[model samples]
Target: MKLLAGAMLSAILLYLVLLLIPGYPPVGEIPFYRDAGFSVIAHRGGRGLVPGNTIEAAENAVDIGSDIVEIDVHMTTDNVLVVRHDAVIDTTTNGSGAIANMELSDIQAYDAGFHEIDYPEASWEIPLTVPSLDSLFTALPNHRYLIELKPTTLPPADALCELILEHQLQNQVVVGSFHSSVLQYFRRSCPSIPTSLGKSEITLFVLLERIKLGHLFNSPGYSIQVPIKYKGFNILTPEFIILAHNLNMRVDVWTINDPKEMKVVSNWGVDGVITDRPDIAISLRERLSFL
Candidate 1:
């Protein structure tokens, strides 16, 4: 009994020592994060304001003073990267086919102005064509962007890297993807560009936070962009925000449109809020400044 008791005490001491150890140093400089403050990231270029991922949507988002326009990308049949949120374009556009199966010209031929359910206020009288990432970047040359890669059979890391480098947007864009393999591949192909936490990384982070060992969590990603809550568990706790800031990482919650929720998250000191309503978020930021 005495031997067992001694072993237990030693294990407890080791655990306490580990808890006292400091975490890894801050991650390397994320150019997109440089000089940034309380970013108002437009979700799908402010889908609530207009047809998502279209040129009009992006323009309106910028006009409303959004800090960063978050978009999704999918590769077309002709090896072109287009700004879109899904592999199938049926929902967002009037088209009805997989993006991978259609060429850029084919996809652009269809009307992308199909926000009947989401944005009835936005105009859809004229046809809005889907845009290529190249064109989007050209139109908004100086803007910051958070581009997410939707799942694709063909790996698009090399193509994406080439495009970013070609346009000299290495410092203005951050890549995001749910697939760990995609993010891992992008990191390997283009280490210069910053990325967000992948699925596995987020899981590990939340687990650590739950176990009270969040200080040890480390990754090369520039930020954590999570929903306010996931699967019925609260994620935006005060402790979570403080821990992320302590590690020099920013935490940005997504898809928050309610005015009350916006005020709550902003009060929690999140780095950014990804929302479908850029106008609302930008306005809230103004009010927060006064407070």
Candidate 2:
């Protein structure tokens, strides 16, 4: 009984020490994406009006005045980091293969704009090609990118950091991933780059928030990005925003497109909104002078 008690005490001490550790220091000379206040983030490059994750969609998002363009990164078989949302190309493109098994040249050759079938009114003036991360950065060098790493589909940290360096975009990009390992990899190698809370990290945050004990642990990431609802529970409450801000962390919600819903969260004091319709959100913010 004494031995077991001692082990438990040791575990508790270790956990407490871990909780007090701070997040990695940010890595940019430029203060791009430094603010999280009442901003509009284009989801999948604001895909409702254009094909998702294409350069055209990115251009459209910038033209529409979104504060950030959220793009997913998947490495090709040839080890090129490309802007794509899926591990498999069959759903969003004309081709049929896992992105992990395809070369960059072949993946780029596929008609990425095929998803535009859903939007007949939006003209595909330029060929919608699957853009490499380099291409996307080149297309919108001045804009911010919220790049989600799909390390399970492709190696993310090393390649992603390299690209950020090559493009001088470490400050302009916010790296996030559902997987903790991917975020950890980035944090270790590129601690200066800002990142969102990983899935497990946010899960723990939700639990602590539920019990009103969230202030106990230091945040693992610089920011938190969540959907408005989780398991039907409204997670982006005003109180939740207060808790995050108290910790000096920014809170951003994702995938919100409805104008009414957008207004609701905006009122909740969220730092930003990620949406498939940045145009509508931008207009609403403008009309209300919310920004």
Candidate 3:
């Protein structure tokens, strides 16, 4: 009876230990990919505080100690690749019409900064200009960049890849796109640069599918940027981060601006975050000792 009771106790302890352990996919086996120091990537060069994708924004992000400055690229009608968020200039710029429909010379004619207001009733206008990718690279050569390739009518993905290579900026850049075709093209042509797939549709089915098959199709080195909330599961949950880490893939959630949410996500051990408020994110990182 004594021996049987001892055996039962041992079984109970083992069960509790197993329950505490996390679950991950079977193919998730890259040992060296431990969570490094958390990296803060400023989305659209910290759009919350400055004109997005502009030189001023990039400079501000860097000044605040962001690990990387993110920017979007779209080619003009004349095939000049410029940094702007939208395919059209109507929203963020003073200019009108699709960016691809306008020549670089035409785009340069407008005052890109005229429409911007720092605060309501403040009425302070900062002069802004859309910068070429080359100009951005030149301005912040030492800083890393997360370049999102905007799908446009001009300057194909191949041409963009060529420009990156010609500038020898491959090592300092991580290219991403919502278009999987662009990612596939980069995978095939510019294999050296790291790539990430943006998460647009967040569903349980898609998350599970990506977990199971992402490595097979997306290459082993690729990462996924998912939302903090997906299919009723908060991505900042320990289970989610462990699952992603085990898969040899880094998880980056986008547009997370709240300091509390940033703390929660960082505590959960997400590898990185893309935020429009780099200043806020950096402050949160310091407060939480997430760095």
Q: Best candidate per lDDT, number?
A: 1
For the record, the alpha-carbon RMSD of candidate 3 to the native fold, in angstroms, is 8.6
Best TM-score among the predictions, by candidate number: 1
Write down the lDDT that model 3 would get. Answer: 0.70
**lDDT (10s digit) by residue, model 1, range 16-121:** 9879998777777677898798899999899888877877888999998998999999998888999988888888677799998899999988888865643556
What does candidate 3's lDDT look like per residue over 28-105, in tens digits? 423222344688988888877776788888999999999888888988878878888878777766778888888877
In terms of lDDT, which candidate is stronger, 1 or 3?
1
Judge candidate 3 at residue 180 and give its lDDT: 64
Runs in model 3 deviating more than 4 A are 1-36, 116-124, 152-154, 198-206, 209-221, 230-237
Task: State residue 24's C-alpha deviation in candidate 2, in Å.
Answer: 14
User: Model 2 scores what on Cα lDDT?
Assistant: 0.80
Residues 35-64 of candidate 2: C-alpha lDDT, one tens digit per residue = 445789998898887888888888999997
RMSD of each predicted structure: 2.4, 4.6, 8.6
Q: Cα lDDT of model 1 overall?
A: 0.85
